[model samples]
Target chain A: MTVKQFFKSNAFKSLAVLLAIVIIAGGLLAIFNDLLFVSDEERFNRTIEKIYGGSATVEETLTITDENGTFDKGAVSAAYKMSDGNYLIHSSGKGGYGGDVYLWVVVIAENGKFGGIEKVLLDTSDGETLLGNFRDSFYENFTKHNDELVEGKYFGTSGSDVINNVVTGTTLSSNAMCNAVNTAIDFFKSAVLGEEVVSYTYLYEKYVDMTQTTIERDFAANSVTLRIVMQANGIAPSIAFDVTVKDGAITAFEATKPFVQQYDETKIDESLRNGTYFVGKTAEEIAAALPDGETLDPAKLEGLGLATGASRSSESFFRAAAFATANFEAFFAPENLTYASYVDFEQSTFTWNYTEGNEVKMHIVMQANGIAPSIAFDVTVKDGAITAFEATKPFVQQYDETKIDESLRNGTYFVGKTLEEIAAALPDGETLDPAKLGGLGLATGASRSSESFFRAAAFALSNYTFYLTGGEQA
Target chain B: MNKYVKTAVDGLITNNATFKLVLGTCATLALTTSAINGVGMGLSVTAVLLLSNVVISLLRKVIPNTVRIPAFIVIIATMVTILRMALDKFLPDLYDSMGVFLPLIVVNCIILGRAEAFASKQPVLDSAIDGVATGLGFTAALTIMGVIRELLGSGSFFGIQLWDFKIGFFTSSAGAFFVYGMCIALFTLISNRVEYAHRARKARELRVPAEGPLDAPGISAKEEA
Candidate 1:
């Protein structure tokens, strides 16, 4: 039969054609549905990019739903910024305790500093303590400091306070946050900042002395050598000080290790290398680096080093130098300097002479880095010969605990002994008697035990004035 | 008009499309998870079914006798397509939730069965009445199923939480099946008794062995050529 005849003959043929059309159409629609809806991973990646300012190409993105088949997108949305920054920097983290609690987080970063944190959406309904409390605790901080959204610096308070864990609740979460922000800071500084900033010191002092001479040296050229001496009679022990180079250009500086026996070696070294830079050809050349129209402080020189990338260690060293300079001024040029009373000076000298006839003397001088406004000293030399010298000031000991302990424990305790001097007297374990306290009339001793030494020293020092006075004074 | 209204109302509620007659089980079971969802699915199917019935009735004479089912399906499917597009644009959420079941409404037994049995034989208005009654009844039954499922399982009446009780029997898939079975059984019991009573009274009044099969409510007898 012909095709037209076949169609005309049977109604089943028409039904067959109709069924065929429907099957084709429905099949086409089913195919279309699969294409339009994106897989879950793409959405997660996009969200992560928004928060961290970087792309996160995660391998897997799991869509979580509650028992009610509803999800809170807002809670998950908070993770966008933190994961991109620093801290919880793991590519991924396993959740706590159960299969239910799936959490991931990253420390918050902005403008190259660790500020806050972000956590991926968590699907924990079990109400378990460790994971649930951690999540809750984290949200609590995020909400409280939610207002303190500074661009950088993770902890709401500022600086090292970022490392402080949540006090009473969610200690685990608090520790986690601390870990994340700390990691972020390290990553940002090491990976992003790319330089170590350091600081240096320059100090000068003038005093009324029998010997008259002018001294000059270049610090950046490494031609200058600094030595500090101490004397008793200070207003405050360990008073804050700074040594500002009023003028000088810092042409260049390379790190140098201090003597093993030196006082405050770690702190001084750190200060020198990490503090702010003042660059120029002379002491006066460096002061121009201060903020415009701001006066440089000879006491608080380290404060200037707080700028971004400033070397903390170098700034601290410069501050120490500035203190020394001011104290030296109080002793040498007592009338020339203000804010400190006059003190005596002792002198010593070094020779730079080549011949007897055309000899030149290089003077090596030690002045007080006057953290304490007490003893001051100087050194003098002329014509390649040692010049007359005397300690016009009363004896001064540097009051460092190490020196006192070294001397007292070795039975060689003396009133005015410095660490260098006491090192010569110590004989291992022999304890000094009270009778040996002679000249200074004080038996400087080590702590009763190493544990309480600092506290005891602080207590003794705080009540020194009261002790000096009789019971009547109390 | 009075007889027509009575027939339509009785067909619509008394012999519901899903419960009493147990027709269109595929769409009924697939879409009834909530009252809103059930209504949306039911109304969509109703619009398609009624339109197809009216058009089929008007063209019954013109349609060649041999290829009637194909022509009827084509008309019904076309109407379903129109409903699908309209629902997609206007009530997208319901359209999405209904998924493939909305298109399946064309092949629904209630619609096809009526088009072949009633619409093909009756006038356009009568056919339209049958379509509405059947579609509304189907909608009502599915909506009840949806309401029961949502309330028992989620402690919610259509997404609004009512209470949370740990009555395991009520809040489960088994519970849904149980409820649906009970409803169908109850409908069968009530309708069967009603039919029996009506039959007994009619038989007694007539005092004969029945003139024809027309006296029966649900049972149908095939006529020979």
Candidate 2:
């Protein structure tokens, strides 16, 4: 076609129209983009307004560096001192169930010290599928227990006692959230407040064999004081004592006032209450002082140069003393101490047994929260399909145990499904799909226990496929 | 009645974007999780639809037919981007709550569908009316669905806790489907009955005789008499 004809053709008209529209649209958008542009400072002020309920100017941009100390689970990325005396910290928590969780934390500052967490908002996250499962109250928990968090009382180094409001199904995410807030708190203490960072010595109930309510350690003096509460059998009131250990020996043993008031005064021995015979004894001597089966005969108590009137009370005292001595040594001895937070797949064990007629039985023990062994199960696989699945040790946790047990112990959830199919149901590094989990009869409410069950099943299936059937390892 | 009024009525009721035409069901289902979300999303869409329809209608004669789709998309996308910026600046809470879906308004069939089906052929005045009517229709439908779902699923109405009783099923995607299906079914039943009554009344006004039984599709016995 000629040049004149080409310019007037339908193709040229279409191209001209599209080009004109694109230029006009782009121009208009560029103008509006400038008009409605949200600058970083403006965005920060907006977030502050939303969280703090009023806008404030930036007082200073605080610097976060290695001098603040390194955090294993998370780090502080940005910090800003607000004109209203609050510090806004942008932080991220690692080791989430899915990946990292990013958060914008507003730390309330008062008189050049950490006040509390004003608010915590999720800025963005990387592949945290179950992030939406958390409610607003979950974030509010940080603000609720700000003082405890600053003192490193709740989420300590040992990770035994986390926040009470940890969501049932999202333990890893909850832990990540705790780590993120703790990072902010730690940075505020070390960098802003110029104070020594607080560290906790957590001891689990399983290892201690008694409830260590409160523990205080004096490293300079090489002594530890702990209160142990033991629930007595039947309707008798629970007994409590404040036991102090100095250089691996019990130095002081005194019953709490509540224990003294509740216990029968006539039957109790003054020597036990006053630490007459139990003082200056080690854990081994303490254990030897108590008779076998936790019952000391009155005659034996007298023969051991101890008060004989309160034999039952003496037995309780000796047992508490033994636990106190052991826990104190464990606390000071780094080799014997096992931090609950460090529990992972390495602590888990998987063993398999083969029955007659092509049936293979696998036993798996796994930890739900890395605090302790939470679940153990046996799966019988025949021809690659799970024939029988039973909970050798039923799933248990601090909360939601009954629902978790009911869901985990339901054999029909796993039976009649092939090992590969069960294994493929849960992909690696992704949060559990609630719908798929529902199809597999896993309760989303009991997510931690369900996750433990899933990990155990995956472990069993991988082992059954690789070791028994000679398949390649996953 | 005026033709413009009739067109507006048609857009609002007969060609409702959510229930009748089933356009923009993605936003309808996704954002109807709460009444406030529904209202916020609905208003955002309405703003986009109204602006895009007017602009496209004005440029219809100047733009060629072959490149209409892309041209229409450019206009709609521009409008959506502007809406997003304005919301982010003025109403950050709504912007945060709407999240990705706020930007996804560009692809919503409601805007493009009206541009091609009505705005591209109609005058500017009529297209503007149609846009408002259709937008309001979608908002109404979403609000209704939001109320039902929020009440059933979250036991709240527009974020106010009425009671703690809730059926969590209503909050899931499956629940959205269920609520959408039920809303469509109920809307169809009610609209169909109203349409039949109006047609019978019109025939009576025209003094036309029924060719079949009164209960037959459009005419009733009383109107025939």
Best by lDDT: 2
Please, what are the lDDT tens digits per residue for candidate 1 over residues A1-474?
Answer: 887887776565556655664575566445544443434564345335534446443333223223211221111212222333343332211111222222335545557654554543332223223331222344445534523434232432111113233523334333344333333333333333443311111122111110212122222232322222211112211212222332222333323233112233333434344333422333323333222112233344544333333233333333334323322222222122111112121232222222233222322222332342232222222322223222223344433434334433232332223323322222232222333233423323432221122121222222222222101111
Which RMSD values do the candidates have, in order? 32.1, 17.6
Lowest lDDT sum, 10 consecutive residues, model 2 chain A, at: A334-343
TM-score for candidate 2, please give it: 0.55
**Model 1, stretches more than 4 Å misplaced?**
A1-474, B1-3, B166-172, B196-225
Q: Write the per-residue lDDT of candidate 2 for residues B60-175, one digit (tens) a residue.
A: 99999999999999999999999988998888767766766787899999999999999999999999999999988899999999899989988889888899998877777788
Score every model by TM-score. 0.34, 0.55
lDDT string, candidate 2, A384-445, tens digits: 66777776654333445566646457666777776556656566522345565645555446
Give the DockQ-based CAPRI class for model 1: incorrect
Q: List, in order, the clash count of every candidate structure.
A: 55, 0
